[model samples]
Target: MQSTRNKLIDLLANNQDKYISGQHLSEELNISRSAIWKHMKELEKDGYEIEARQRRGYRIISFPNKLSENTLKWGLETDWLGNTIIHKTSTTSTQHIAHHLAREGAKHGTIVIADEQTGGKGRMNRPWHSSKNQGIWTSLILRPEISPHQAPQLTLLTATVLADVIYKETNIRPYIKWPNDILIENKKLSGILTEMQAEQDRIQYIIIGIGMNVNQTIHELPDDLSEKATSLRIETGHQLDMIKLVQAILEQFERTYETYLNEGFKSIKTKWESYGFKIGERINVKTMNQQWEATFSGIAPDGGLLVENKHNGKVEKLYSAEIDWFRE
Candidate 1:
């Protein structure tokens, strides 16, 4: 069931150009006029400017710049992706919270988000810097019907979603480093960590953790990561609305994910490659026992990194390896 507040937002947003009578809002939301007025006061406190006149209904003149469950749902245009949002002001990690929720039978499209993560981690358990209200730190719960082996495709699919949103929102073309990193001008902008729990051939649940640096300034970043990491604000010369960016991501992700389910991985593979960083360029590849150089070809069907072997002219799919993108 949709919350009454969200329903009110939808009713007002759908008719932005005109006023909605208080009686109509009350009838549609099954709430009294006093309750509706109280809700309006709450929205005003959340930074929403609503215009209400005598005999005229209410219309939202502007949305809030803050990030909250209600603000996020105010103008979010998704069917289910963010319908059930678990927002936190500060937490250990959204990923950790998501895992707990999924184990407790959280529904698909349930999202866990935090304004700040005290112990955020990325792939390989690397500590991810999540300053308070400086970036987007969220996790999504997915229960796909596909087998365990096919789960990696979702990671690649998510990369495409991030790249698409970044380009469209900032107008700066970003690149996807093999596996799960979004880069702009050879610097890190965002990272994705995909974890799944499966039994036999069936996946129980998958948690995709996404951490994006959005509004942090140079001084806000750690000194060690100053050169290696970049944020949307740093690159764009202005702060971005975190709520809007999150909505855009959820909207695009839902659309792309639906397409992937209806069709296949072919489209996702193509889109991923288009945003693939350093494709066709020689890069260093490192494994446990050996290191070699290969031309970054593309992504294989099973989500491995496809590289053209420097020797013998054979193509190989690498499931796990440390790719040195900085090395020539």
Candidate 2:
């Protein structure tokens, strides 16, 4: 069943530049004029300024501009990746909400977006800063029947989706700081946080949180991060339609996810490696106590870093390490 409120929102957003007549809306959507009026009143109650007049019918003046269902549905042409949107004004973290939603039997492709996340978490337990109206911090819940080990592949796929959208929108090529961090010219632009609830053999649900520095100015970043982090606006020198960016990302991810499901990772492995961080370069890494410089080989078939130590002429597969490409 199509909801009248959502249809109205879609109509207004799709026709942002022109006035959509009430008779047309009623006829096209198969609803009555009084019902449309009731729905418009409902939307007004939800902070939408839908103008009504004698002949002009209705026009959406303004609304909360974010990654809401109305925005994604209007912009995204996908079957999933935003089928169910959970929006909050402020929360501890969208991932937490997604986890709870998953526990309560939420469907796949459920997305949780927050305007401000007080305790926003990062990949390695780092505190993610999510102030009011500064950036985009959201989480997506997916239920793939694969095992826990295969979940990391979703992270890689997400990295590819995000990078693809960023490149498509800004025409500013960004680099993937392996595992999953989108970088622009060498500074951090976005990070992916993946969490899961699984059994010993089967997986129940996985929540992938992506925190992007979108629309935030250079000075709005923390002092410690101002030198190493950048937003889409800072990188592109203009503010982006954040909602549209989210829509684009979701659409790309939906396509890629379906492809990965139907065709497997081998189909996209070449594309991933093509955009890989370093092709043939000697890099230094700080694992835990000792720092070593190793020749950067390509990734293993199972997605592990292959490094050859220069001093010993020995090779080892690294499951985890901080790759220091920048000589700082």
Candidate 3:
């Protein structure tokens, strides 16, 4: 259910080239002209510059540079991925809020985003530094009909989307590090964490959490992460529009996800491999039993990391392993 204000924004944004008269807005939103005026004032307060004339009704001249539900939805071009957005000024974790919402039967495509996360975490409970207004911290709820075994593919698919978006936005090519990390010039840029709740054979829901360092500076990052973590601003030497980046991610994810569902993981595997970090390079792979060197081959059909053994002359798929990506 879209709120009246959101509907009003949609109407105004969709008609950006022309002004929507107050009468048309009133009739479309089922509100009085006075109420429409109040809504316009509210939008103005939210940093929207709206133009109004006697005969011409209203047109948004500019949108806010803030991260709000309305601001994100204003220029969002997705169908279902972000139709329901839960934005927070501050939260412990977007992933935590998303899990709670999914448990409460939040519909698929419900997204939880925050300007700052007090306790953001990545895969294996590693704390992720999410500075306020400096990055994208978001979790997306999805209820795909695929089995739980196929869930890992979504993480890989998400990496490709991040890489593609970064490339298109900054013209910088990013690498997809095996399970869930996006790297640029051997430094971390973004990460994807996929969590799922499922029965024996059916999945209840899956939450994909993404944290991207967009506008952080060198000093903004913690001292420990200074050597390993890099941000878009640091890489490009310019500030970026987080709202536009978020919109691009959602739009690309929705389209790629639809294609993956209809076509299967074949296409996703190809795309993922194209941006694979250290592909065909020797890397240290550590399993439960032992650690060994293997050439990074490609992704298996089930989304496992395929590595070709140097001594055995055979290819193997590893589902769980610690890869020393920097090892020579």
Best-fitting candidate, measured by lDDT?
A: 3
Model 1 residue 57 lDDT score: 80
Q: What is the C-alpha RMSD of each candidate to the true structure, in Å?
A: 2.7, 2.6, 2.5
Query: Model 3, range 47-141, lDDT digits (tens) per residue?
Result: 89999989988998887899888888876888899999999999999999999999999999999999999999998899999999999999999
Better of 2 and 3 by TM-score: 3
Displacement of the residue 282 alpha carbon in candidate 2, Å: 2.4
Best by TM-score: 3
lDDT (tens digit, per residue) of candidate 1 on 56-121:
989889877778889888678888898889989999999999999999999999999999999999
> TM-scores for all candidates?
0.90, 0.89, 0.92
Query: Which is the better candidate, 1 or 3, if ranked by lDDT?
Result: 3
Pairwise lDDT winner, candidates 1 and 2 = 1
Models sorted by TM-score, best on top: 3, 1, 2
| Global lDDT of model 1 | 0.91
For model 2, give the RMSD to the true fold: 2.6
Error of 1 at 127 (Å): 0.5
- Cα TM-score of candidate 2: 0.89
